[model samples]
Every structure is written in C-alpha cells, then in structure tokens.
Target: MTGRELLRMVAAQVCVHGVMTGTRLAAPLLALQIGYSAAQVGVMLALFALSPVLLALSAGRLADKHGLRLPMHLAIGGATLGAGIAAIWPIFPVLCVSALLTGAAAATTQISMQRHVGRAAKNTSELKAVFSWMAIAPALGNFLGPLIAGVVIDHAGPEPAHEWGFRAAFAVLALMPLITLWLLRGAHEAPPEPSEEAPADRSVWDLLSVPQLRLLLLVNWMQSAAWDVHTFVVPILGHERGMSASTIGVLLGVFAAAAAAVRVVLPILSERVPEWGVVLVSTVVAACALVAYPLTPGAVSMGVCSAVLGVALGAVQPMIMSVLHQITPPNRQGEAMALRIMTLNFSSFLMPMLFGSLGAVLGVSGLFWLIGGLLVVGAPSVKGLRVDETPHERPGDPR
Candidate 1:
C-alpha cells in the first residue's frame, strides 16, 4: 500500500478500535449505575463478544466472496445505530441488544480492515509491519477514548458518561470510517477475483481446513484471551485495590502508550528474528511480566511490569497477522482475516464473566496469580511455525 493509503487505513483503525474497546472499560461503570453486580458487569461485557466469535468467519467469507468496501460501509452504519441505541436507552434489555450490535459492528469493521490490509500487504514482513504500525492507531485511540469518556463521566453523571459517551463515540466511529472511504476514493479494490488458481469454496469452515491456518487461529485465540484478562479485569482489580479513578486512567493511558512505543519498532525488529522465535520470546517475556505483576511492591512497580507486559503483548497480533497473510491467497484474504477475528473474539468473549467469577472466588491478587499461571502453561504451546514460512514478502506478488 502507498504511504498515503497506509496512513488513511491506520487512521480508520485508530478510530474504530479506540471506540469499540474503550467502551469495555466503561462497562463496569455502566453496570454499576444500571443496578448490575460486579459479576453481572463482566457478564454484560462478555455477552457482547459472542456474535463476533460465532459469526466473524461467515462475515469474512462474505467479504471474500464479494468485496471489502461494502461490509465496511455497513459496519459503520451498525456502529452508528448501535451507539445511538445505547445513548437513547440504558434499560437492561436495550443495553444487551446495543452491546451485541456493537460487537457485531466491531466484527464487521475487523473483517473489512483485515481483508484490505492482508490484500495490500506485499510480504509477510510488510504485513507484520502494517499490522504492527496499525497498533499505533488503536493504542493512541485507547488513550484518547477513555480520557474523553472519563471526562464526560466525571462531569455528566455516570449514566450520561456511559450512555451518551457511547453515542458520541459511535457517531465519531461513523465519521472516521467515512473519512477513510473518502481517502480511499478512486483507490481500486485490491482483493483478487476468484479464478481456477484460487479455491471457489471460501466458507468459514474452509478457513478451518488448513492446518497452518488453524494454528494461526489458535495463536490468535490464545493471545486475545490473555489480553482480555488485563483489559476487562484490571480496572475492576484497580478499583477493588483502592486505586483512584484518575490513577486507573493514568495507568491505562501509560499502558497504551507503552504498547504503541514498543510496536513502532517491532516491525523492523521482526525482520531480524524468525517469526516463531519472536513469538516464543515474546510469550516468555510477557509471562515473566505477568508473574511479577501480582508479586510487585505496589502500583509503581505494577506500572513498570505493565509497561513490560505491553511490549511483549503488543507483538503477538502483528506476528500472527503477518503469518496469516503469508499463508492465505489474496482472493481468500477476507475469509482468513475474518476467521482469525472470529477465533480471537470467541476465546475472549467468555473471559470477562469467567474471570469475574474467578476473581470473586480467588480475590484480586488470586486472579492475577491465576493469570500468571495460565501464561506459564501457555508457554509450551509456542512450537515452531509452519514449515514453508517466508521471512519477508517476495516481489513477485506486488508490494
């Protein structure tokens, strides 16, 4: 992709991702205001993730069979409508429906963007770089979105903070995607048309047929599940531990910035290291950090561990995306990308409620200890990557 196109895509990524997940942090607050218990709050968050987990592959197949722009446009509309629903009504059933729509919209957005990026990426390394650099967008967006929401929540009541904030955020999600469409104006579609060379069966199940692709999806699933533990659990943990709202906000911003900073250089660094090797090392590093986090002296020490955790955690998605791009045919990029999203969302969807229950049983420190242990157990799963892996994109395909 041209630098200009890259910039536009990154910008859209930032806006959509920032809003979609930033609301996750606000969910507990919303739940509390709406008369839900802590467990209910976690359940609410996890419930939203179900559609993406179950349906992303089909969405991907649709994108693959058809095209990228159409799904993306529809996703933007879904996001807008979903957010509007939340803004207008904060009743129990409405919140559930709105959250589900938001989750579906997020899936729609991911399928479109990943397919575009996968089709556009010239090589495995470039794909990795594009995915990694794209992290900067959401990393930045996560920082801004919460701060904006926090300000609104603190000023407006908690109800307005969540209900209206989602409305405003989705309104912005709608506008940002529109700008990306405008920027991509006159840009021809890059996903390949089906021919004898590419398989005609581009179903979600087709996404599962390839063993190498299956491994990649597993990696995506595990990595997302690991990250969700922190994203959904940390604020709750912080609140329980007597951390101030401002401090929680500051720590979150720091973590996002740290993650972006690490990702900025990972694209170049990934070139020098074998992809599988990078995964191995990153997992180990992240595990060590998480293991240390619960044992740390306090928040200062915890933030330090969190930054280290960010560096390690931020590397996984791009590495997997790069590999997925390599194994997938250009024509099937949408299916492959959507399949990964589906898997990731599926593993993550149940995390919040499960973790909340565990947290309730185990206590906050106990929850962190369990998280640390899970990472340790997951370390052994990082075996060698596919045998035919290419280190970088070859010029034959088109850069």
Candidate 2:
C-alpha cells in the first residue's frame, strides 16, 4: 500500500476502535448510573472481554478463508447496531448485550485488521512499520473513547441528565463505524499472499505447539498484564498516597502520552534494535518502573515512573506482531493473530480479578512487587526468541 492509502486505512480503523473503546467504557458507567454494584460492573466488563476469547478462533478462520473484507463489514455493522440499540434503550440488560456484541465485533475487526496489514507488508521493515502504525490506533482510541464519554456525560448535567449523556455518547460512538464504512468504499485492499508451507488443515492446537510461538504468547501476555496492571494499580496507589483524583488522572494521561510519543519513534528503534532485544529491554524497564511506582514519594515521582513504564510497555506491541507474523505461516497469519488476541483478552478477563484480590490482601504495594517478581521469573521465555528471524524471511537466512 502507498503511504496515503496506509494513512487512510489507519484513520478509519482508529475511528472504529475509538467507537468500540468509547462504547465499552460507557457500558459499565451506564450500568453504574442505573444503580448496579461494582461487582456487577465488573461482571459486565468480564463478559465483554470474554466474548472475544470465545470467538477469536472462529473469527480468524473466517478471515483466513474469506479474507477481511466481508468480516470487517459484518463486524463493524454489528458494532454499530449494538451501539445504536444501547443508545435507543439506555437500560442495563441492553447495555450488557451491547457490550458483548461490540466486544465480539471489535475482536473480529482487529484480527482482520492485523491480517490486512500483514497482507500489505512485503518485508520485515514494512511489517514492523505498519504494525507500529497500527498500534497507535488502539492507544488513540483508548484515550479518545473515555475522554469523549466523560465529556458528554459531564455536559449532560446532573444525575438524571447524565443518563441521557451516556445514551448520547453511545449515539456518537455509533456514528464512527459509519465513517469506517465510508472509508472502506472504493478502497482496494491487498489479499494475503498464499503460502505453500502452510497446511490447509492446521488446528489451533497445532499452532500452539511451536516453541517460539508459545514464547511469543508468553511475552505478549506478560506485557499485556503489565499494561493492565499499570492502568488499574496507578489510581489506587495514587489515592493511597493522598493525591487528588485529578492529579492521578493527569499522571495516567502522561503515561498515555508517553506511550503515544514512543510509537512515533518506533520505526527508527525497530531498525536498530532486534525484535527480541526490544522485548527484553522493555520487560526489564517495565519491571524497574513497577518497582519504583509504589515507592514514589509524590505525584511527580510517580508520574516519572508511570511515563517510563508506559514507554516500556508501549514498545512491545509492534514487535510482538512482527515476531508473530514471522513465526507463523503466511496463510495462517489470521489464526496466529487471533491466538495473540485470545491470550490478551484472556489476560484482560482474568488478571483484574486475580490482582484485585491480591491487592486487597497484600496491599497495592505488594501487588506491584508481585508483578515485578513474575516478570523476573518469566524472563527466560523470551531468551529463546530468535532476533535474527525477520518476518517475511526464511529461517537462518541473513537477509
């Protein structure tokens, strides 16, 4: 794809992701507005995350067989419809259902998007650059989604009006998918290049048996958990340290901003640092930041830790995608991508509950130390990763 085409595609995908993220964030808030307990809100979030896990493989298979075009259309349509229904109904059950539908749709679209980018790449350079560019979509979406939802709800006035604000946010999110649809119009997409080495009848288990792929998943999951824990733990730690809500929010915002900044420099970094080296350095840096996070004396110190953590965590995604594509067969790239998504969503579903309980018992400080410890234990998983095996190149070749 040309630079202009890549930009247009990224813009559309980012908007759709923004809608999904916005809608996902709004659903739990809507449930809370209607008087649901925190436990119930957690359940709703779990259901949303769990939907992606259950459907990921099927979605990948569909993409591999039929290509991303039809699946993207269907997934985006479901997402749009789900948001519209939540907008029209504005009730808890409808909101839960909306979350599930949107979640499934978003997962499918992401797999398709990965496959789409994989198709566009002719070498490791393009793959790393493209995937790095794609990583910005979610970061942008995650930031925009909650910000838009919060702004709309705030503008809607006091409690009763705030309910309408949530509804309006969903309405607004629903419109983004339409823009994605428009972007899809008249745009030519490259189909994935067929691979002679990929068997036509590979099972999901077959893919998992590869040692390097398993290592990739492990590294990917560890990094994903770090990202989640940082987001979840920072506010709690900040509050414990007597920081105001706004101060903590700004700290989180800085972390996010740092992440976005790192992506801009990622292509250059990828060129110099091998993929395995990047993952190893990021893991070590993230662990160091986590150790510093709970021990920071004040907001400024904590913000510095958060920014370092964000940069470390931020550099991970594109490398994972590039390595994953390298290890899997070209034709089965969708399944490989799905496996990565499945592991991440699985982490999303389970980590919060596990860590929340741990935090309650051991305190947030203990929890941070525990995460750092776990990263230390798992450090060897990435040790086996072959940094020289650039995606789109044959094994052991120095191309």
Q: Report how far residue 25 has shifted in candidate 1, in Å.
A: 6.3
Tens digits of per-residue lDDT for model 2, 1-399: 677877767777777777778877888877887799998888887877888899988898788777768888988888898889999998888888888888888888789888887778888888888888888877887878777877877686466348778888888888888888887787676754534344555688877777788889988888888888888898888887788999999999989988888987998888877788888888999988887788888988988998998899899898888888777766677888888898899998889878889888999988888888778787777767765533444322233
TM per candidate comes to: 0.82, 0.92
Model 1, TM vs. native: 0.82
Q: After superposition, how far is residue 239 of candidate 2 from its true place, in Å?
A: 1.5
The reply for model 2, stretches above 4 Å from the true place, is: 156-160, 191-201, 387-399
> How far out, in Å, is residue 100 in model 1?
2.3
Tell me, what's the RMSD of every candidate? 4.6, 3.2
**lDDT against true structure, model 1:** 0.67
**lDDT accuracy of residue 107 in candidate 2:** 85
Candidate 1 lDDT, tens digit per residue, 1-399?
877777777776665555556455554577687688877776777766787877777677678766767777676666556655655665566666656766776777767777777677776678777877775776766666566656655555445555665555434443544554565566557746444134444345655666777777666665666577767666876786789988776766666667788888998898888677777787888777766766766678778877887778788777777777777666567667777776666666666668878877887677666766766776676664643734443212233
Off by over 4 Å in 1: 22-43, 87-92, 149-177, 191-203, 232-242, 357-374, 386-399
TM-score for model 2?
0.92
